[model samples]
Target: MIPRSRTVSLLVLGAICLAACSSEEQPVQKLRPLALKEQASNIVKSADGYAVTWAGVLSNANPWHFGEHVVATIVGHDAKGAEVVRMDQPLDAVPPGGSLAFTGQASATQKPAKVTIQYRPAQWRQAARIASAFQRFPTSRVQTMRQKDGAFLITGYVDNPYSVPASTLVVNALLRDKAGKLLGGGSTFVDEVQAGSPPRFILTVSGLPKGAEVAKTEITARTWGSTGRPYEDLALSGAVPVHTIKPTSEPFAVDRNTQIVSEYKQ
Candidate 1:
């Protein structure tokens, strides 16, 4: 038999080796932050009062999680460089390798000449591995009608191709002039969409520059699982069913200029 001290030393060495192997198998994860960028095309105007329209892109740079509770602050400055209005808005979740396009508007009595935007990220957690479970079906029969009041009305249909229901179906439309200059944009939201159901959407935009006509129109649609809880909770509660399937296509980026009819030329 070996000496007692030698046996104790060997046991201690074995214990240390076991601990090192355990740590290697289950490594601690470092927190990854979200990245955001404000689009230069964010529109700010002084209508009857101080009207501000803001838009930005939020990207999830994480490798395996979603960014939730993202907040944005919009500060408006008057011609004299005084703060006119400040407002904070919350954006939707951004999944891994995906980005969210967010828009918000605020109105005050003071007119603003310039506007600034800032973003604040709250939490980064593992997202449901089923990003492909939610999808936007093919939009059908898009029609554009120009009203006498210089407002364009775009009507279309959106379908939910997923087997599970989707919440908060948002449709966004961007209007650009012949030179590819963005004129104005608008978005509409739907509360819920049943599986395999096609819902109709109507988006309208007004106040275009005089003699500016829509040369190109870009439309996109997205759907979320639920906004009430966190993504992790949703996944655990079966709110967002996870699947091994992959997304068939990227988000919609359909362009249609044939349906656009303008009364004036730019």
Candidate 2:
């Protein structure tokens, strides 16, 4: 006859082994930090219906690779600043050096609501499902500014309220336009000040020709990290009309005015 104590001991040992194996059998998704360049396009042929394309800009770092179906969602307040569009769709995974666009009814989806798209591997099936049910977006913001002599400088910070780090990014800035044309070349990118440190880059304003007046300016970041490449965050920007008393007399190759103005003309 089997001993009662022996039976109990075997049952407990089997249960412990089963628990350990169960934990090992579970899968995990690759949640890597990535940055994306998002550009909106009017993919829809007709002007009436809703069709917008969100293109991704793959960078040398954190390239987008396709695996399983990635989900897209947009949530934002309507014109009245009330909750408007809240859309979600399962899109095909975007491979490296690829793009993703969407066409849908404006009425069916949230108009101005913040949008997001997320994904992972098929083994970790829940990647598409956890969903950005949370309604927190990295809002637009300006931290500081510095302009002197012929040099203009800007500083700011962007906060990603998402789970992963936004690696693919484009700082969309209309750098000091003058005479109805863009003046000065500018660069926007993150630089690693120190090894193992995240990233910190500044936007510089330089190279404006003389006699040009500062028209308007705006800066935004295009990040593919968002669930779906969301619209450029205009809300996260700051601009100041500056009058250069010292006027940047640097001539941009003698100022080639479109129809043509060049003291050293060809």
| Residue clash pairs of candidate 1 | none
Global lDDT scores for all candidate models? 0.64, 0.39
After superposition, the stretches of candidate 2 with alpha carbons farther than 4 Å from their true spots are: 1-146, 176-181, 191-201, 224-266
Q: Write candidate 2's Cα lDDT for 20-64 as tens digits.
A: 998895574444432334322112223443333232222212133
TM-scores, each model vs. reference = 0.70, 0.28
Q: Lowest-scoring 10 consecutive residues by lDDT in candidate 2? A: 231-240
lDDT of 2 at 266: 58
Q: Which candidate's TM-score is highest?
A: 1
Q: How many clashes in each candidate?
A: 0, 21
Give candidate 1's TM-score: 0.70
